[model samples]
Target: MDSLFLVLPLLLSASFPHFTSAHNTAPPPCHFQAIFNFGDSNSDTGGLSAAFGQAAPPNGETFFHRPVGRYCDGRLVVDFIAKSLGLPYLSAFLDALGSNFSHGANFATAGSTIRPQNTTLHQSGFSPISLNVQWYEFNDFQRRSKIIRERGGVFRDLLPKEDAFSRGLYTFDIGQNDLTSGYFLNMTPGEVKAYIPDVISQFIAVIKDLYNHGARSFWIHNTGPAGCLPYVLTKVPVTAGQIDKYGCASPFNEVARHFNVKLKSAVAKLRRSLPKAALTYVDIYSIKLNLFQNATRHGFEHPLRACCGHGGKYNWNKDHGCGSTVTVKGRQVVVGKSCKDPSKAVVWDGVHFTEAANKFIFDRIVNGDYSDPPVPLRFACYRH
Candidate 1:
């Protein structure tokens, strides 16, 4: 009778298997453990003005009540990226006011650039931290994190050799400012086109450097259709009555196409060179195209029009830009006006996007809809 009981217990154990293996077999949560963001105003979350206290209006008023240095009504692309990854909103590392480096931090500064000439946005003589400087900051973060771990006596276990390779995702969304600033500086579209290849080469080098620093996964965004931006359309002299079917300027779209071709090729070559790296190209160009093509579907009434502006001819206010305010009836009133629902508008300002627009882009990234192969590299890697 004792031998029979022992045999029965052994049979049940064999049938059930170990609890640890069962847990391991179950799919882990689909969340990005960490996020590292580097870019411009499109993703800057209070990095610039927070450091200098330079005031801007209508920015961050949508969600955060007061301005948060994100040159938009609400969240920027970086915020959406973190949200999609299930991580908290990435704070700006330099934002002494609201700086937090727990989950991740933003190293992007407004008016920064990929190339030296790209810093033309700060036409006022004083230059902000360029992309090169931002990279230096990233290096500093790594050093500081290592120091903290070592001093806390957890370095040996917390930062294992494999941790270097297991470092989190890195995202970069820049170059639009470079092109826009060039246009503002009186550089013709042809001249800007001639200079973009060198700019792309510099970008490639930056990515490679990050890879050398143990960054295995990368998300790079192609330049969006810049000519469609309100800033460009208002500034650059497009030919009268020459608009594409989507109401965008033809010459500008042509420039964007040219840049995308070179960038796509460069990314492909980089992938070949760095076989172990998972470099995924986010198709901002295509995503923007989709948004423009299906503007009504996205609920945008006027994709080409700036939401916060007042002017008769150009659909933008000449004297007052977005965030400018005026005194009205003994109370301060914001100069620009927003749509009843920002989600129904695409252009947040003369150059950026609305929070809803960012949400759409995030959806594309998370759902693996932005890549040419129609699957995000993160998911594809896990599946394999």
Candidate 2:
């Protein structure tokens, strides 16, 4: 099901938080010249769409007014992060046409995971552009972009400065797909949990690789509550006992929690190994779960149901999802479309969050309230 090709826009902005150094002096905010992002749909600007095809219609209607690579109806969390830092939106590293990499590049593709999948995109709907592949692409871009810039002309203006690599902020929001993929393959939760250590080890290796490549600042997000997503609840079979009071699947959420714990531990280990690097482990799972737990208080309706899509308890159908075109009577008609307003709902499609929800989550996390070390995003360069 294409609906399974999910993306979560992990972004941070709003409400600047204050942080002081060991000397009791405030650490000045970091001047991040650029951002080098890697992950899945949560932070992907257009990697998968540019690789396969555009995300079709009504996908970007809320903000861009047309499909512009993002799976959400409007901006993603990464978009807010760029704007908050006074940088332009990151151009997808895979987007070759009319793309300018002056500010930064996003390597996240929809349905991507930490470990490489053994199935074709058409067969399993999982992106072949795994985390390691994205790292390779980043490594190559870092080298080639400089060489091209040296040639001067249009290339120089399009590519980022050489120093941008070291001064840039590296963000990550992946791992959910790894768990989901296991479930899709009929693996039990315990079975999926078994490989988490290996999944985390691979993730840690990539971070170390980036560190070796001069990446000094990182903002890594643990996967969110996958059980709360409409796609998982509707697509995956779960018993009543598995459902939590918040209407989320407890088994899936528990697995996600386990992943977050391991990821946090890995980040702590990275801090010890890559002592020079500034790593911020953001607790996005708690932030998102709170939103669902207090949907009305957060001004959201149907936190578990998708704003777009057709026919089902959650308004999600794997076959006829948001923007799905169906041939009614020799003529194809778009039955899956946007609702009256997407802002009021939390989930946009069956997987992604609406722009409003993205902003809501962004506003809270940017202040460092949900981040380890409680450091604001602007000052994420500091290890403290």
Among the numbered candidates, top TM-score falls to 2
TM-score of candidate 2 to 2 decimals: 0.94
Cα RMSD to the true fold for all candidates: 9.4, 6.5
lDDT of 1: 0.70
Tell me the whole-model lDDT of each prediction, alpha carbons only: 0.70, 0.89
lDDT of 1 by residue, 106-204 (tens): 888776678765233335322367677778888887777766666555443332232432457788888776676666778778987998898789888
- The positional error of residue 349 in candidate 1, measured at the CA in angstroms, is 1.4
Supply candidate 1's per-residue lDDT for 20: 19
- Model 2 is weakest, by summed lDDT over 10 consecutive residues, at 4-13
Clashing pairs in 2: 8-42, 9-42, 11-77
* Candidate 1 ranges with C-alpha deviation above 4 Å: 1-31, 118-127, 151-166, 312-314, 326-333, 377-384
* Model 2 regions lying over 4 Å from their true place: 1-24
